[model samples]
Target: MADLSIDFCGIKSPNPFWLASAPPTDKAYNVVRAFEAGWGGVVWKTLGEDPPAVNVSSRYSAHYGKNREVIGFNNIELITDRSLEINLREITQVKKDWPDRAMIVSLMLPCEEAPWAAILPLVEATGADGIELNFGCPHGMPERGMGAAVGQVPEYVQMVTAWCKKHTRLPVIVKLTPNITDVRHPARAALAGGADAVSLINTVNSITHLDLDRMVAYPIVGEASTHGGYCGSAVKPIALNMVAEIARDPMTASLPISGIGGIGNWRDAAEFIALGAGCVQVCTAAMLHGFRIVEEMKDGLSRWMDTQGYADIAAFSRKAVRNTTDWKYLDMNYQVIAHIDQDKCIKCGKCYVACEDTSHQAIARAVDEAGTRRFEVIREECVGCNLCEITCPVDSCITMVPQESGKPYMNWTQDPRNPRAEPAPAAAVVEQAGA
Candidate 1:
């Protein structure tokens, strides 16, 4: 059995799975139910100073797949609409009641020292584990000088982080927005501002789809629609890249990360952890399938960990960072050619068509003695691009098989084709050129 426990920037949880600061954690009722359903922690929905944020009806719109599964979720919803006092009181009671579960309060306010300074003490008084500066929300709050409005600007990210660090005794985790051209700038800014950790990535700015009849985007309000924050499985690849960038960067390598975006299963969570997330947060998955999904997540992760010989999360945490590198550093000599399994091949010409028309002409089609259609890999022409494998409908029908080239490992920098390749011994250069 593997232990899923994690100590994220001093806030301990039984497992690495936590509910993100979204509708799922909006109130004590929702949070309590999540905890009861086996969540290890919850970031209370973004809270603001009193006269709370007003939300609109029909605030959510989802992008669905062919089977009607949510591929992505978009929202124009704002932060918590409950009063600050009520939120604080509830946070206090919930933290006291569930001392074992992590209680990190997410807060957003006008970018000012006064507002931040005032709210820090009130939230700290709730006995919460920590405070996550909600600088990542992309919709309703940004217009008010909060959320991505502040996060997109490195200066604001640093200043607000400094203010929160100055006023609060709790660990300040800066929630970063992904809207910026470069995510590292804001992450570095957070570290400079004395942030304890950073969580990302906030929802992307997107309008899922437009209603052709009404000529308006989704989540239509009357006859108008504005771009909202986009999340869910579709954004996982983007999120993973960002997390890997931060984890491998020299500037913020030591910073703790709470991974958010498109995490629905144990594999997704494991990928984030391997890329250096201290914990993983879930929102869209919970909304789509309910909190009980965490049970599957926990069980699947634990079982997989056992098979991998990992005793705890830390055992595999950030394990992939070393392997994540620039394209220039990749071994040019390493090669793998596609192999077609005749037994498993479904005789589908999708792979053949895809490779012949769009990619390298690496697959040959013919008829066998029985006049049955057959497809085989043209290994000599295969560039090891994996296009055939990806297009194949049957699993494992096309597998990439590594060849025994017996060639020395060489990166682009050392390759002879590179005009600025590093100088090598005459013999070595000749050998490489011949190879």
Candidate 2:
């Protein structure tokens, strides 16, 4: 089997799958159970100095998909409500008991160097693997000048990261918020301040639902509600893009990334690693399904890596970064036309209806020799948009076939369609003139 272990900025875990800092890691009981269930590590839920933030009733709201599967989850819950000294004691004991598992502590403190400085040494004494700066909580914590408040400000992100680095010898992973305008700025700021690694993305600011009858929002507390941090499958794309941006950025390219947000399965984890994450963290999936989900994730990822002949996580990590590029760098001359397989086609005219009515009139119905009507593509009018393929119910029944255009390489930056493009060669001009 392929090795699943990773050393993320010197915090080595048995595998790359760690429970993100959330309710799942809120206490030693939960952390020990999660470790017993085979998770490689856990980022103990966000801890702070002195009195902990109190959470209210109905702290969570969720969006459901078809068949009532939870697709997205939002929460107004604050950091651990227990006292700081109790949390530290439990963290220290948990580390002692599960000495092999990675135990990184998550922390959110007032945006002062003093509070951060005070907590770092205390957490380091716990024998934990590392600490993650929780600058990404989108709701309650932000209102208190912490969490997203600090994360949204690049200067604060830099300054606080510096304080943590100054106060602790442990690896510092700055958790970034997705609520910001440009996530890269804060990511760059984390690197500028000597952060050992960066993790993202924290939850997105969102309102999951509203109760129309009551004229109030979901997770309605006393008939009132506030926006909460949103996480789960819905946020995966956003997380992937942000991770890729930082991974590809020249300034932060070498900085280790801990990918978080909407990682539900092995494929999701694989995609994150391919995009340049040194490891991946999960919360919602484990929260919904339980800690046992990590077993499937591990088995599936290991089997896949073995099949691909990868020796370890590093062999394929960041493999896809090279293919990610700006729109201007895309090939404009590449062409593909959709082809429909008559044998596999159930004669469902859904594709024809979609193409002819809503999209390009690229398909038409015609009678075959047996007098049975069949839909055929009008190649001349086809734009190769793939709308027909997407609308087809049968999988692989409609496939995009590459067309031999005999055109040389051209991108948006070099295409004649772009007014700023350089003058075309005489041969190209003659060819266009003949057409």
Candidate 3:
């Protein structure tokens, strides 16, 4: 078996899986149960200053699939609703109970150094391992001149991170906000401010649905509603791109990254690690299913590593970054064309309609004798771009097959693979050679 253990910014975990700060990690009771279920560590739900913060009712809304299950989630919930003293006590207890697990406290308060200075010692005295500055909460804390308020301005990000570094002996990880235009700007700020690691990305603004009768937004509790942060499996690609941006940037490339947003299972975690995240964070998956999902995540990741011959997490960490260069560095010679199997076709004509109306108009359709819709690929007119394959609903109904002989090479006219190659009507060369 390959080892899934990871040492991220001096904090070691049995695996690279850590629960993001959300409802699941709200207290010690929930975290202890999660640790037992195979979660490696947890960033406790963001704790606020004394007296704590309050949230609203029907605070969460969901976007559903055909099955009517939640695919995307929106939340107006703020920081820890519990008092500081109770949270500090629970952190102390949870750390003492699970010494092997990473207990990193998440905190959000007023953007003053004095507030940070006051809270750091209290959290440290609880025997917690480290602290993650919650500068990424997009919804609640911004009104108070915190969370993304501190995140959007690079100077504030650097200043708050530096304050945490000065006040606490624990490792400081600056959690980044994705609401900005460039992810690298705040990432560079964190590294400059002496942060040991950085985690991303807090959710983006969203409005899931609207009520027709009342003409109000979804989960309508009153006369009005505000946009909440959007998250789930749908946002993973966006998160992956942002993570790669920071990892590939020369200024902040070496700093450890904690990948957050839309991580659902082991494969998602591995992809994040490959893209240069030191560890992975989960929130929506746990919220959608339960803590038991962690068991499958850990098992699945370990099994994949064994099959790949990776001895440990470090062996494959940041492996994908090497191949993720800018667009100009990509291989221009790669080419492909679309293919459709007549025998396997259900004759839906969906591909033809989509292509003709919205795409390249490369697919032609006609009704056969059996009154079934059939689609044909136009050889000369086809651009071979594969847009039809993407829009097609049927499985294995459309495929993109590369053609090597019938066209001019768009990116590479000549290659070592086919030196002294003659142009197309390539079939003529074959016939002449046979004679």
lDDT of 1 by residue, 375-401 (tens): 988889999999899988899989999
The per-model lDDT (C-alpha) reads: 0.93, 0.91, 0.86
- Give TM per candidate: 0.96, 0.94, 0.90
On residues 159-253, what C-alpha lDDT tens digit does candidate 2 reach at each position?
A: 99999999999999999999978889999999999999999999999998899999988888997999998999999999999999898877888
**Residue 141 alpha-carbon offset, candidate 2, angstroms:** 1.1
- Candidate 3 local lDDT, 212-256, one digit each (tens): 788988656678778888889877888999999998888988999
Estimate the overall C-alpha local distance difference test score of candidate 3.
Answer: 0.86
Candidate 1: stretches off by over 4 Å:
423-435
Q: Candidate 1, overall lDDT? A: 0.93
- Say which candidate scores most in TM-score: 1
Report residue 270 deviation for candidate 3 (angstroms). 1.8
Report the lDDT of model 2 for residue 303: 99
Better of 2 and 3 by TM-score: 2
